[model samples]
Target: MSVLKPKIMMLIGCLMTSSAMATEVEPYNKANAQQLKQSIYERTATATSAIERYQLAKSEAWLSYADHEYSEGGFTSAGKEAYIQANQLLEPSNVNLVTQIISPSQVMRRDLWWQIEYLKQRGALDVEPQALANAEVMLVWAAAEYCELGWRHAREHFISAERELQKVIYALPEEKPFLNWSETETPELSALNGKGCHGVNPDLWPLKPKTPVEPEVIDADVANVVVENVVHFAVDRAVLNTEGKRVLEQIANILAEYPDMNITLKGYTDIRASVAYNIALSQRRIDSVRDYLLEKGVNSSRITAEAKGKLEPQDDQKIEMAHAKSRRVVVYFNDAETNSITVQPQWRDLQIER
Candidate 1:
């Protein structure tokens, strides 16, 4: 056999005799194992460009051995060490790949613990194991939930991001309160570094949406549909002063302008006397206006006379003037069959109760 062949054989023989290393190897002892270990070492060395490359190649061999141990149904402590060593060799340069692999799983999805563990594995953190792991975990969770928004509810992502960012900001060292990051780094991993977790886009979360204004509804069919305020009051007391007459004239003009418009004359009074007395007073007030309008040439059917006793008022006019606001007539134009009345009374001659 060649000189190198004998050395390879001797090294493999020694490796196989770990349980009894002091005992001299016989010629036939673990001949296959001796050949395999030597071949593994030789192939690793051949793949290398330099010592560093050799180290990486050795790491791969260690990984293969660990895989073999796992496949054999029992892993030794030494096998775990080999696996860890292999991972360490690959971690720093392969962060993005590792993140991609672990990010999608439910347990590791944007989870801080998993992120911290990953960073620790890559030797990015030098703190106590627990602290480093916990801190990274929070940042990972925040980035996953808030950055680009993965497969989770928006609200849940927002809440989780808030909590995680708060922890990361507060726990960071005073001198290095910000995380080290770069654009070319793992996009998902780098996205977690502090900025506005929720500030990706503002127009997306609009402060206020544009709204359309509705046009004011006016019934052209009603002749007395005056935009100006009109008020009415009890009989004898229902007499319109100069200002009241001006308002009344506006109503009349509105009716004249729209020939098809009809009017409903409603009268009301406060609870001054008995209900019956108030009811009569309201009817009288409405009649007085109807007579005046009739004399003014308005058709009797065009105006519907109705009375409301001591119920509706314009103002709580306890004195004569304020009472005048309460005791008044209201003209509803478009309410012919079905329409909601939205106009408020600004003028009236109705009784105001204390």
Candidate 2:
């Protein structure tokens, strides 16, 4: 069977063109190209050592290949050959540039996997376990892309990424930063794992599934209690400020009074960023609130947190005030008459006594 069917190759061609079009513009194209060219030449001229020269050469090779691919409107055999030549110049010392500038989509070949292993063997990525893990995840994604294209080496890339991820997981400490492994559900992961890649080892996975916590029923009298406080967050942050903590304290006190009443924290964000980023940020905001409440003696089961992301904006206007109003966490008790309270424009505009 062909690695990539004609239709799949056509779709990839469309995507590559679209990506270039999205970033290119009439006024900037010529200037950007000239600037890149100048930078490359300057870097090459300033190279004082063999390593520096090799790095510069590799960069030039990649840039040349990228230009060709963009101009030609798709990946070509010449581009792949240039990439392979560039790969020979890569060493552990160049890992920083490789990680920062090279993306999986740009180097979707066995050579990419070779470079990854070369860096690992040299212990250059020892301090960057998290980054290595992320690269592995991207490799898995790239493998899936290759599989769709019907590339013969798709399974090889998947197995390589899986092994690299496993190594990183083994070296990591018990406590680590949040790594979204939800992409493991991709058909590629399942397909590759079924072939004995073992990419879905839960023991090494950082994020274990949490048991669903149900909200408690609110008492008839407690249902009359007003629940309209909006907890604010700093721009692009999930850490609660002094004012946010104070607001949560008030909510905690109320929850203390009504033991049977449950509170739902719905998080939101302004639409300034991508949908995926905003959604993640919104979830982090509510998680910050839920954690603070838990610390203040609020029952975990009685509080439920949900992320509405940019979907539920209090005001649709793109002004600063509207943006501030949109980036908030709204509190609602399970049975409280909460619908009447109007969402204020900003944290400062709230009627709450500071």
Candidate 3:
């Protein structure tokens, strides 16, 4: 009977209504392929983020496969390859790579649902709001894919999509109530804003504050300095966390002290997802590190960033420790004196297990 209870109930009602509306869409038709492809390509071309680009690529590949299946009667070998390529950009497992054809339409829908769920589990909802929007779009696309397969597939997809959408909607932050409100907010309603409500936990949103680290000094007289302080990142995150920022702060101070020294940040990732995704993720991480250095007053000309992705994992074993070690960015430093004195760069020929 509390005032906030009514507000919470109203919000839930509205979300349920939206979910219902989402399920009432018409059946997908083959003739929409060209239009869908064009739309997807346009989005890809203008996408500012890696996730957005990958989402568009997935949509393009799905539509292309659908077009081939409906118009040409079943998937052509070439078309299947294209599908695999597109799938590889987001996740690069060998099992997904070696598949000869696209997954069953319903299975694909389920896979999309799981991928979105994975993102939500990993705290992407708070860190990357666009991912939530992309997930919703993907669900709608999955529903359409099911529509093409027939009534039963469509029904299953619709139900799945509705469930997923409801979760996302409930996860979104609620608006603050007016200060002058006559009624008191219940403890449950207040807790929703802080710790989340209706199965959503705001504390788990992955946006933790980063602690600062003291900067390290690099010896200018050294022939080559490779700081073993590798910056680690969470899965699919380009933004630096507190620990990462601290490491970069140290690197920035080193760069500031040795104005003539140049640094390269080589980014690498664990073998969890696709090569393309890892590569892109690595680049973003390095870029973030480099940008932090620049912000800390390092010359842009003295810094460079490179991405090796999953091709150069620190540990190739399929273990948590291996994956943790692999998701890192290493700093390599060289001064004019050091570069001239050394016959060969230390890490140039270093072999890393993929």
Candidate 4:
């Protein structure tokens, strides 16, 4: 059995999925022939060095061959081989321009993986519907690319692809009228989507843009994911207990190992108090946690503390324990998914003051 190339197959699938009326050449078209040809000339001419110029020339030659092949009929075997060779020699900059300005008009062959790159150039942020759809196309193609590359960095690309796809999904009701795509497609797309790519929280994707920095290393096989400890205070009291100081020490040691990791100290409280009072109490707890961490030499910017009273309880069962758990602050490593976690033996038995 013959295996169809992913790009060619995907294009065919897309065509099959859409109505022929919807397949009109205008809405999907990026640029016209004159514009495309002009871009080719401009890019080729504007190339700064001999190397860049040669690469652009090679890309233009391939575009010419592709146009001829599509419009004027088949090429000779030798001519086809020459076209392939010229394409292989093209640089990434030239390749990007060719795809961005020309690929929409060309016949997508087995080697067609250019459309996704074009869409990546227009990420999902504040883009039009067609552009966002094009980004989704890029995302699907990115999955195929990652499958082909099979590296750790491929995880980043795969996640980015999903993010773009998600934006398209979120905007669908606003974009197309009376059109609802099946949620079943989510499983297929979600398979390759890696966690922690959707920004700081998993719930928000594409909208929240957080840099995925590598966690810092501290001791042997230990990395600091959070630079400070999350401490709980009694009501409005900001005093630190022995156990609280011990937790801070643990956080400090981890920070010493990995001085670059950022920390988020979140405070919570029991539901016994009024909403406003609890909110203020939570805020105070967070501030206290922040101050403690800052005193331990952690940068102020690296530490962000927030208080949410009774809103985020640890568990509903055992109300007292849950309330106690709620009245405490917890530290989170910004990039915990990619980092190794270490638990100091003594820090496991923490008993924060009520």
lDDT tens string, model 1, 83-170?
A: 4444443322321211111121122233333333233323222222223322332333334343335546334533443333333332
In angstroms, how far off is 287's CA in candidate 2? 0.7
Model 3, C-alpha of 19: deviation from truth (Å) = 60
- The candidates, ranked best first by lDDT, are 2, 3, 4, 1
Q: How many clashes (backbone N, Cα, C below 3 Å) per candidate?
A: 24, 5, 4, 3
Worst lDDT run of 10 residues, candidate 4, spans 101-110
What is the C-alpha local distance difference test score of each model?
0.43, 0.50, 0.48, 0.44
Give the lowest summed-lDDT range of ten residues in model 2.
345-354
lDDT value for model 3 = 0.48
TM-score of each: 0.31, 0.33, 0.32, 0.32
Better of 2 and 4 by TM-score: 2
lDDT of 4 by residue, 113-149 (tens): 3222222222322232333433333333343333444
Off by over 4 Å in 1: 1-226, 234-236, 313-322, 335-344, 348-354
